[model samples]
Target: MTIDEQTVDKIAHLARLELGAQEKQDMIADMNKILGFMDKLNEVDTTGVEPLIYMTDEPNTLREDVIKQEITTAEALSNAPDHDGSHFLVAKVIK
Candidate 1:
């Protein structure tokens, strides 16, 4: 497919972009080049190629989930610069 100035203008507007005349012309040429490249790619034959999901052959390596030491509430709140005994305190945000 060929890209024209009108198409470039419409695309720029949709993208919320302000393009000058030179930039619009450049975009039109660039888009046409990309479309031409895609068209060339379409001419390639891939009759029995399997779609690739993963790039590597290695399987997922994960460690077993295990619980470790758990700290008490008082221990957790000990280092807080501002806290209301149970929870950390912060400045009010909502109006």
Candidate 2:
């Protein structure tokens, strides 16, 4: 399919883009070239080629999950900028 100025204008409008007359003409030419290349690609024969799913053959590796000791309340609150004994304090967000 060939791209024309009208098609370029429609595409630009749909994409919310502002293009000048020269830019619209340039875009039409560029789009036509791209479509021409795609048309050439369509001429290639691939009768029995299997569609690719994954690029690599290796399976995903996973690590075993193990139970671990949880940090104490004091340890968890150690990095707080302002804390009231066991809980963090912050400025009131609601009126």
Candidate 3:
């Protein structure tokens, strides 16, 4: 699979990118080179290789989540500029 000028144009349009003529040409060349390298990688022998999930084989240790402190709703609303006893009030932003 090779990238052409038309393919690069379509890709640019999909990505909402505005490329100059030279940039477009460069993209085509770069994309074709990437595909060529991928094709070469596909020719390598890997019949008995295991897929790598991580770089090392160490178990991840996670600590339990515990609430250290708690506060009342009134305490939380104390510093608000505007509130309605239970909820905060703000200017209407959407029509």
What is the per-residue lDDT of model 1 for residues 1-95, given as tens digits with 9 covering 90 to 100?
A: 69998888889989999999899888988999999999999998978998889999899999999988699778989999899899988889998
Using lDDT as the measure, which candidate wins? 3
Q: After superposition, how far is residue 16 of candidate 1 from its true place, in Å?
A: 0.4
Model 3 alpha-carbon miss at residue 85, Å: 15
Off by over 4 Å in 1: 62-95
Clashing pairs in 3: none
Candidate 1 positional error at 22, Å: 0.4
**Candidate scoring better on lDDT of 1 and 3:** 3
**Clash list (residue pairs), candidate 2:** none
Error of 1 at 9 (Å): 1.1
Residue range 51-71, candidate 2, lDDT tens digits: 789988899789899888699
The true-versus-predicted C-alpha distance at residue 32 of model 1, in Å, is 0.8
Off by over 4 Å in 2: 61-95
User: How does each model score on TM-score?
Assistant: 0.62, 0.60, 0.66
Q: lDDT of all the models against the reference?
A: 0.90, 0.90, 0.92
Highest TM-score, which number? 3
Q: What would the per-residue lDDT of candidate 3 be over residues 4-77, giving only the tens digit for each residue? A: 88999899999999999999988988998899999999999999999999988998889999987598879989
Q: Which candidate do you rate higher for lDDT, 2 or 3?
A: 3
